[model samples]
Target: MKQQYTHTKLIELISNGGEDQENAIRWIYSKSGWVSIVKKMIRNLGGSNHDAEDIVQDGLINFIMDVQKGKIQKIEGANAYFIRSCKNNWLNNFNRKLKAREIIDREFNKEETSINEEKIFVSKEIWEHLDRLLEQIGRKCKEVLKLWSMGYSHEEIAKLINYENANVSKKTKSLCIEKLKNMGLNPDDWKY
Candidate 1:
């Protein structure tokens, strides 16, 4: 257990900027185990330990800088302010990622993502075109699309492609689609 500080005392110590500042930062990090509390909150909010670590680091830096720069003169509590900053950071990061994914989905989904009902990919001519396109991309691009079109789970694609995890496989699949789109893939062009 660590001791808590009054906002005035914390502000003074941090403003002075020396050994006092280091100790003040330490107190803020460990007082009543607030760092663990922050990390737990992040995990509860669907973030990973790595994300928690990043948020905590950024929060500490911003808090210290703000206090030193006279940006935070009064506060109900330093802990609340610090945690709120981190929560906002996480939410912002999550939204940015979500928006990026939406953009990728829109770009990759201009046409129907699925092929013919038989899964032979419309016709043999399309297969040849796809083969050429896949060659331009990479061998794994073809397999990723094939397995994905066959309804194979991302976890399955990860194992098949030696990716570290499902998330990596999913990102790879997105990249493949982006590459194909860059190569001017139009399903309508392959239609007889």
Candidate 2:
């Protein structure tokens, strides 16, 4: 018989990272019924097998990232969370494709038109700058900011990062945010 993983064991393995990270992902893929649910959702939406595979991959990556950053809250169970996340992602992708098709049809039917390419270029530049600023901050600061952005309580952050206490976690996160602001990064602009 195949081994089965409980929700608690899965969460511990995923959150722990390092050697456990790969195993956790493998367990998720191999042990859950959620994968079939995701595939069925996509198929019902007229997605091909390739699309199902892609959506599953993207969903897993997003779910893992959210888990690591502590963005997930109000957990009912691991299977439900994974299925919901994948369904949402697939729906979003389908909507984006519909919008793109509409835009392309409109463009083909119209003649030359004005587009504010400069504004887009400037926005891209600003984002690049922000990315650089984030990288400039030390690794620890980045970790703290990420966890805080993910909506982790100070106590939770402290336990995750091995800090002495919640107070220390709060102080460290505050200082990191301040440093980011001094370097021209608006804390409000960043999201997990």
Candidate 3:
């Protein structure tokens, strides 16, 4: 069994671009390098195989993008970084799914309650405003902001969104946030 993942090989493959990058990806998959890493992460995190695969893909994308942008200079402990990114991506995805379920449950329960019509109308209006603002932002920017709002760290956001690094993610997030601020929505407006 190949114990060491050839980080230099992968980086070189990615840097070369075109068919070389594709071949490198194929090599990784063929060796089950990322898959094994993700499986271990999933097991550690108590996630399923499917979740592990998803996380692995997310990490691979991040690594490839970073290499292509010449953002990652050091390959020392690259495997550790890959594992960390995969775990973070899995956690973020899991949290979002769990939150979606909570929202659905709340909505179902609310339908059974005798809530005042006025309050419902106000809540709907607020959601609509949020939706409109989100629509105004580009899809990528909206996703980045939403992930940030969900309390994902800069590193996690970079992995999830395929930014070159946390610094890049922070800068892009700042730009998106400024756009939102300019549109008149302040942090104080957030209920939670």
Report the number of clashing residue pairs per model: 0, 0, 0
Please write out the lDDT profile of model 1 over residues 52-147, one tens digit for every residue.
999999889988877865778867677788888889988977875665565558657773343332233234566787778878987787888877
TM-score versus the correct structure, for each prediction: 0.53, 0.61, 0.51
Over 84-135, each residue of candidate 2 has an lDDT whose tens digit, in order, gives 8888888877865665565567668984433432223244466888889888
lDDT value, candidate 1, whole model: 0.79
The better candidate by TM-score, 1 or 3, is 1
Q: What TM-score should be assigned to candidate 1?
A: 0.53
Model 3 lDDT at residue 153: 92
lDDT of 3 at 59: 81
TM-score sort, best first: 2, 1, 3
lDDT of 3 by residue, 1-192 (tens): 653436676688778778988887776665646668678769788887777777777788887776665666565756676677778878876765665565567777874423343333355466688789878989889878877865679999999889899998899899988998898775554446
Q: By the TM-score metric, which is better: model 1 or model 2?
A: 2
Worst 10-residue stretch by lDDT in candidate 3? Answer: 112-121
Give the Å shift of residue 87 in candidate 1: 0.8
- lDDT, each prediction: 0.79, 0.78, 0.73
